[model samples]
Target: MLKIYRNTSIFIFLVIIGVQWGFYKNYTSEFPNFIGKTNIIHIHGALLMSWLVLLIVQPLLIKTGRTQLHRTIGKVSYVLGPLIIIFLFLIGKGSYWRAIGKVPEHDILRDMVLDSRGLISFAIFWALAMLYRKDAASHMRYMIATGILAIGPGVGRGLINSFGLGIGTALTVTDLIALAIVGFLLGYDIYKKKNYKPFLVVFIVFLIGAFLWQVRDSDTWQSFAKSYASMFY
Candidate 1:
């Protein structure tokens, strides 16, 4: 079990880089000039980045035998985690408002499904991680799952902006990458005879998200998404 978590920091660091690399073309490239961006974007970026940093450092702390410090940071996440989720919803709300009348119903429906499912998945993973805090193996796996979840938005956007893939293609590729990571983890867990349920659960959640994306154009989803968006301010 300890062996499985030993490389968590390295994996999370790579994910951090992937996220930044994805966002750079459109978001970070502007750098100091963040002129037109809203407060929610800045706040969400700060909170999400902080969570990523915490995710990376927490594992390193445990690996280095700084269990006390790891616990301290874990406690901090009691506040930090919910804030990140709230900001995610706010960002989604902002997206809905901004895209209304500007994009087609299909686009709006798809975006909402992606946004809502991502939020729900992240919340589920984080909550389960918190609940399993006493179970190091489960906790660590779920924490790692959150980092995987975080990478999708930036990476998907990067694919669109940098590779010129259409939004649909970029999103599909991003979902594939996420599932690939989860699949590798699940497979390795099985090979090592470790508990594979954590990654299996994450994989199922992600698959559901991907499935929703595939069928987001359906009238049922479109109507639900419209109603979901209306729930926000």
Candidate 2:
């Protein structure tokens, strides 16, 4: 099991950073002289990227037999985790508001569903990972799930920016990729006769999120979204 996770986080980190760099190549091209970049955006990027960095570092510490160092670094998530949730919500809300009138209402609402789903899924997985911190196997799996959730946005952006795919199609492709990854992990765990519940739960969440847009036309969702945004966003 440890071998299975040895470099998995590194692979996830690279994929996430690669997709994000490709997707936002234009913005990143500006480099140190990033004009028009807001502080919120900077903070948001820092928070998320830091979490990914931690994921990479933590596994390495363990692999090096530095268990104490790994535990110390893991504690950083106590502060980092909540900051991530807050900023992710802020960034998503900011984008939604900024897109008003500029982007179509249907598209905006659909995007919101996908964004909120990812946010909810990340929070759930993170919480579970922390809750199961004593159980190394479960804890690592849930943490991996959170990393998998982060991939969706980067992949969506990559699909759109690299291939000029429409937002809907890009998002759909991202969902498919995420589901496939989780499905493969779940199958592997089952085959090994290991506990598969964690991956199974994450797979269900992603599946629901993939098909969630089908309910965007319902009045209840629209009303709730607007109300929630008005209060929190």
Candidate 3:
């Protein structure tokens, strides 16, 4: 089970990197427009990549018996985690502003709500992981949940960009992927440890998020989003 966890962490990290790269490829031509500017997009990307690197390295450290170094580096997440959420909010706000007049109303609303839900889930799982850091089993489960939450936006983007899927379909695909990952982890816990509490918590939170994502462009949500976006503009 330990070996499975370590290998799965590495696999997830690689998949995240690949999916993000695919998503970015869609915007490669516009990269130069923001190259010199100090933009929220760049900050968000850097912070997220840093977190993903830490996720990959932490597991490898454990696999190789470098617990001291792993613990030392884990301290960085104390700062990194919150910064990621902050930058994510900024990115979402910036995106909303940029699209207000040009993009379709439904598209903007959907994107904003999806981004918000991902950030919320990431924060919840990260806080849980921090609270249970001393319990290696529970801590790692929470951390993996965080990773799953974080990858959702990238998965949606990859689906839209690579497969030319509609926004609704892309988001549905992303949620399904997230649900499958959580289910696999929950099954592992039940099989090996007879403990599914943490995974169950994450799964429930994710399902709620998935539900919200599916209805983000509804009239009620659009009204809420317009009210929220008015604050920044």
- The regions of model 3 sitting more than 4 angstroms off are 28-38, 104-106, 231-233
Candidate 2, 152-198: lDDT as tens digits? 77877777788899877877887898899999999999999999999
Give all TM-scores, in the order shown.
0.95, 0.91, 0.89
Q: Write the per-residue lDDT of candidate 3 for residues 98-210, one digit (tens) a residue.
A: 78789898778767877778778888988999999999878888887877765666777777777889878887887898899889879987998766999999999999988
For all predictions, the C-alpha RMSD in Å is 1.5, 2.0, 2.4
- Go through the candidates in order and give each one's C-alpha lDDT: 0.86, 0.81, 0.80
Give the winner by TM-score: 1 or 2: 1
Listed per model in order, the count of residue pairs whose N, CA or C atoms clash below 3 Å is: 0, 0, 0
Error of 2 at 57 (Å): 1.1
lDDT ranking, best first: 1, 2, 3
